[model samples]
Target: MNPTPTYRDVATVGIGGPVGSGKTSLLSELVPRLREEGLEVGVIANDILTQEDANRLRERFAGVVPEDLVAGVETGACPHTGIREDPSMNLQQIDAFLAEYPGLDLVLVESGGDNLAATFNPELADYWLYVISVAEGDDIPRKRGPGVVDCDLLVINKTDLAPYVGADLEVMTRDAREVRDGPFVLTNCKAIDGIEAVHEHIVEGVLFA
Candidate 1:
C-alpha cells in the first residue's frame, strides 16, 4: 500500500490538474459534500493572474460556503510557486484560517490547474490530488508526469464529456493504473456521479476519518 500522507498540524489537501480539467468543478461538488459531513472546510485558490476561480467559487458557494473561508493567491510566476517552490503564502493562509476558525477540519488548496508537470509541496499539503479530464485524451497517463505518478490520488473527471470529446476512458484508466500502481477514480461532476467516492477517498485517505 502507499504510505499514509504526511501528517501536518493542520490538514491540507491540494487539488491540481491541467487547465479546464474540472478541478474547480470537483471543488464545487466536494465543498458541499464535506459540509454535509460536518467538516468545516476552508479553500484557497491559487491563480496565475486574476482571482477568477476564487471569485467564481465565492459567488457560487455564497451561502453554502463562508465568504472568509475562500482566498486567492496571485501566483506571480508559474502556477507552481504558490503550492510548491515557496509555499510560504499558502502556509500563511492556512495558519490564518486555523487562527480565525479554530475548529477548521480541513483546508482544500486548489492550484491554478496547470500542466501535468505541476504538483504540491508537502509543506503546503499533507495530501494532494491530480485531476485530469477524459476530455484531455487517454495519452495523458502515458505521458507519465509527476502529477500523475506522485499525487496521493488521481482523479479523472468529465466522464460525461468523454464521448463528445472522443476520449477513450478505459484506455485512460488502464494507463493511469499502469503509471500509478495506486488509487485512481473517475467522475462526472455535472451529473454528480462518483462524487461520493471522491469524498470517501479524501475522508479515508487524507482526513483519515
Candidate 2:
C-alpha cells in the first residue's frame, strides 16, 4: 500500500561537462569512495546512442556496486535535452532504481559528453556538478558558460595536464571565482587528487543536507 517513489524521493546528483572533460574519470573515483562510506549508490550515464560510458562505469565499479544499479539512457538527441529540456528519461531511471532498491542512498547521473551549455533540470538532479578540463583551454572559465555558472559545484579537472597544455591554473582559478558564486574544486582524477573534496561537496550538498 506504499506510494511509488519518485525521483525527488531520492537524492540525485547530475554530472555534466564537455566531451573529454574527465566526467567519467571523476565518477570512477567518487563512486568507490562513496561506497567506502557505506552508502548504497546507483549511477545513470546518458548517451546519444551508446552505453559506452555506462559500461565503463560498471566495469570500474564492479566489486563496489551492483551491476543492476548502473544504467545507460540513450537520449538519441542532444545531450542536454535528456537532462535539461526534457528529463523524463532520467526521472524514469531514478524511479526504477528506487523500486528495486528502496534504500539506495544516492544516484549519480552523468550526462553524455556535451558542450559548455549543458545543464541538468532541477527536477532531475537535487544537486549538480559541471566539469571542465584544463586540456580544453584556460579560457573556458572566462567564457562563462551556463554549466559553469549555474551548477552547484564547478570541477576544474586535469590539473596534471595544465602544465603540458599551457593552461594556467591561476587564471582558471581567478576566472572560476569571478563567474560562479558556488564553490569549484581543482581535480586531477587520474591521481585521485581533489576527489575527496568533490565527494565532500556532494555529501554536504545532497546527502547530509
Candidate 3:
C-alpha cells in the first residue's frame, strides 16, 4: 500500500524545454528569487539515465533549501514519460520532499531534454513553463509545437545570444505572439535579466492571483 501524500499545501510547477534551451539555467535564477519572496521551495530534476542535473541543482541550491528536498528522477527513456504520460516517479519525489519539509510552499519539477511536443500532464503540474532559447533561432516560435502552444508561459531564453546566433529577437517576438495565446518573456537568464517578469507571472498565475 502506498503512503498518503503530504504535499497538498505545495504548488507544483513544471519547467520543460528542448536540450540546451537553458531550462536549468532558468531554475538557477528562479529558485533564489522565489526564496527571496519568503517561500519555502523544493526542486526535482528529471534526467534520462543520470542524476547529473539533480546533482547540479543540489549544489546550486545548497544552504538555501535542504539538500534532501532536491532530487533527481531517472526516466531511462524519453523525458516526457515521467512528466506527461505517467508521473508516478515525479509524484513520489514530491511526497518525499513534503515529508521532509512540510512547510514547502512550491515545488519546481524540471523535465529532462525533450523535443517540441513535450508537455506536462495536468496531474503533475499546477502550472508549467516551457523554455526555448533565442540561440535556437527566431524560427522556433514559428514551429508552433504543442509544448510552445500549450504551456502556461513560454520563455525565450538566452536573448543575449541572438546576435551571434543570427536570431532576430523582434521576429521571434512577433511569431511567438502570433502562435501563442499565452504570455511570453525574453530572458538572458545568466544575467538575470527579465527574470522578474517570469517571477511575477508565476505569482499572478499560481501563488496569489
Candidate 4:
C-alpha cells in the first residue's frame, strides 16, 4: 500500500547547465544563503547514473539543511529526460522531501550536466536558472541555446577563470544581452561572489516580490 504523503507548499527551482559549469557550486552557495534568509530549503541532485553530486551537496549543506532534505535521483538516461521530457522522478523526490520536512519553502532541483538545450519541465519548476562557465568559451552566449535563452535567469560562472581560459566576459555579456530578454549575472561561485544577486532573483521571481 502507498503511504499517505505530506504535501508541500513550496517553490521549486531548477538549475541546469553544461558539465563543469558550476551548477553544483552555485547551489552550494545559494542553499546556505537562502537558509540564512530564513527559507527552509530542500535539494535534489539528478545524475546520469551516480549519486556523487548529491553526496557532495549533503556534505556541503551539512547542518544548515537537514541531511534528509538532500537526495539523489539517478535518471539512467539523458539528464534532460529526468528534468524535462518527463519529471516524475523529480516530482516524487520533491514529495518525499515535503513529507519529511514540513514547511519547506523551497526546493532546488539540479539537473545533471547537460548541453544548452536542456530545460526543466514547467510542471517541475516554478522558476529555473541556467548556468554557463567562462571556461567553456567566450562564445557560449552567442550560441543562444534554448537553456540560455529561456531560463528565468542566466548565470555566467567562473569569472575568476575568465582570463586564464581566454574567455572574454565583456563579449559574452554583450551576446547574452542580445539573445535573452531576461537578466544575467556573472559569478565566481567558489568565492561566493555575485550569489546574492542570484538569490535576489529567486526571492523576487518566486518567493516574494
- lDDT (0 to 1) per candidate: 0.88, 0.94, 0.92, 0.92
State model 1's lDDT.
0.88
Worst 10 residues of 1 by lDDT: 1-10
Clashes of each: 0, 0, 0, 0
How far is 85's C-alpha from truth in model 2 (Å)? 0.7
Q: State residue 4's C-alpha deviation in candidate 3, in Å.
A: 5.8
TM-score to true structure, per model: 0.93, 0.97, 0.96, 0.95
| Model 4 Cα lDDT, one tens digit per residue, 71-166 | 999999999999999898998998988777768999999999999999999889989999999999999998989999999999999999988999
Worst 10 residues of 2 by lDDT: 1-10
Instruction: For residues 61-156, write the lDDT of model 2, one tens digit per residue.
Output: 988899999999999999999999999899899999989999989999999989988989988999999999999999999999999999999999
TM-score of 4: 0.95
Cα RMSD to native, each candidate? 4.7, 2.0, 1.3, 2.1
Best by lDDT: 2
Clash pairs, model 3 backbone: none
